[model samples]
Target: MAQLIKLEDYVSRYEWNAYRYPSQFIRMKQDNWKKLYHLWRNEAFVGDQQQANMEPAASKWKSLFKFGFRKTAEETAKNSDVTDLPATENELRHYFLDKLYPVQLKWASSTVTEVSFVDQTYYANDRLKYFLKRFPDTFLVMYHPVFNVKKAPVDGEIILISPIGIEILYLIEKQPGTLITADGERTWLVKEEAKSETKILSPLLALKRTEKILKSILKQADIALPISKVVLSPTNHIASLKAPYNTKLVGKHAYEDWFAEKRNLVSPLKNHQLKTAEHLLKNCRTTAIKRPEWESDDNSVFPNDTV
Candidate 1:
C-alpha cells in the first residue's frame, strides 16, 4: 500500500511552512488555516515509518505498504513521522507526473522572467487564494491541483486519484497583447498592434492532456467524476488570440464569475483525503522562487524565505 503521509492544517504551520508564493498553497489551504496550523504544530508520529500526528481516523492507510508505520500502529512514532499533514512534495515523483507539469516547468524556466510575468502569476494566485479562504478544501484541489514530473510523456506522473474537483489550466501570457478568435482565424495583438499568429502553448491544449491523464488515473481509482478546466489569464493579453478549439479563456476580471458560476463540480474528499493531499503538495520543491506577499496571512514561520 502507498505510505500514508499525515500533515497538520496549514494555518497551524503558518509559522513554519511559509508560502514563498501564496498562489500555490494558499489557493487550497485557506479555510483550513486555523485547524491546519494547529495540526502542523501539534503533529506527532505514531508508527515506525514516522508519519505525522493525524487526527483519529483522519488519514486512511493505502494498499501498497510492506512494513513499518504502514504495518503497525505503535502510536508512538516521532513527530516527523506522524504528521497531521501529507507527505512532502518530493514524494510526488514516486507517484507519477501528469502532462501539465512539463509545460508549466518550461514556461517557468523559459518564458516567465519579468515584472509582467510576476504580476500575472500573482494575480492568478490571488484569485485562487480568495476561493480557498472561503471554501477551504471543499472547492479547490490540493495545492498544485496538478503536480509536475521530471520526464514528459515517459515517466508519467501519477494523478492523486480520488473524486472530482475543479482543475484549472493556467495560460499566463508573457507579453502584453490581444487575441482575435471571432471566426476560425487566430492572431495576436501586440501593444494594441495586430500580428499574424505564432504557435504557443494554449491553456486549452494543456487541459486536454491533463484530462487524458486524469481520466486514466481516476478510472484506476474507480472515480468517474470529470473535472472542468478553465483558461485563466492574469492580464489582457488573453484577448489577443483566438481560441479555435474548445477552451475557456477567462480573464482575471471575470475569474470570480467563472469560478462561482461553476456548477455540478464539487470535491468528494473526506477530511482525511483533503488533509493528506494538502500536506503532500505544500512541501513540493519548486525552482521557482517566491515572488512577493500580496497579502499577509500573518502566521508564516518562514518569513525571510518568502516576501
Candidate 2:
C-alpha cells in the first residue's frame, strides 16, 4: 500500500489560501488513501481520472457535473502542488506560490519597470508579470503609459518595445462565444449561446487610434519606429474570431508561441538596442511638459539662404 500524505504535512496555511480552496484541498488529503488504493487496483480508472483532470476548466466542470463528485478525486492526485512534491513541500510551496500571489503586494499601484523620464512609471498585473518573467531580456514592457492628447490624457494598457518593432497591446477580459469583426467598423459582434448577440467597441480600432496617438507623440522627439497593434484576450474562452488586417488577435494559449516566434526573428545590434531604449525612455513620459517649437527670426532663417 502507498503511504498516504496529509494535507497539513504538505501545505502551509498561506499556500492553501493562495492557490486552492482550503476546504477542497483539505478534503482531498483526507480521502487520498482510498484514491490511492483504487489507483493500484484499477489502473484504467486512474488513467481516466487523470485525463479528466487535465482538461480545460470549462470541459473539466462539464465532466464533473455529468459524473458528479469524481472530479475532486482526480484533482487530489493531479493538482500541481501535489505532483511537484518537494522535500520541504510547505516551504517550497510557499516560495513558489508567493511569486504568483505575493503577500501584501499592491500590484495596481506597484511599478514593474524602472521609472523613466519625468518620474514616469509602469505598473503590472499578474498576467503581464507572467510574460515578464518568461521573456525578461526580450521585452521592455511598460504598463499603462499615459499620453496627453489635445489637453486630455489617454492611457495605453501596455507598450512593448523590442528590436523587431513596438507593440501596443490592449488586454480584453475573457468573454464567452464567437467574435466577428468587419473592416472599417468601430465595433464587433459577439454571439453567445442560443444565438444571443452583443456589440462592443472593436479592440483593433482602439489599438489603431492608440497607435496613431503614440506615433504623433514619438514624432515630436524625432523618433520614427514601426508599430504594431495587438488585442490580447488573456482569460477569454475565444471560440472563433475574425480580426482586421495587420492586427494580431492573440488568445492566452497562443501568446507564448507567438512571442517566441517574434523573439527569434528579432536580432538587434547591442548598441542599436541601447540607443532605441534610451530614446524611448527619455521621450515617453507620463507627465513631461511639452516644449514649444523654436521660432527663429526671418533674418536668422535667411542668413544662410540669402546673400
Compare the candidates by TM-score and give the number of the best one.
Answer: 2
Clashing pairs in 2: 174-236
Compose the digit string of candidate 2's lDDT tens values, residues 177-282.
4443333357666665677777778777678776887677567756667788887765554444455677777776776777677556545323333344444433
Alpha carbon lDDT of each predicted model? 0.35, 0.43
Candidate 2's C-alpha runs over 4 A off are 1-124, 176-184, 234-243, 252-256, 262-307
**Reference-based lDDT, residue 194, model 2:** 72
The global Cα lDDT (0 to 1) of model 2 is 0.43
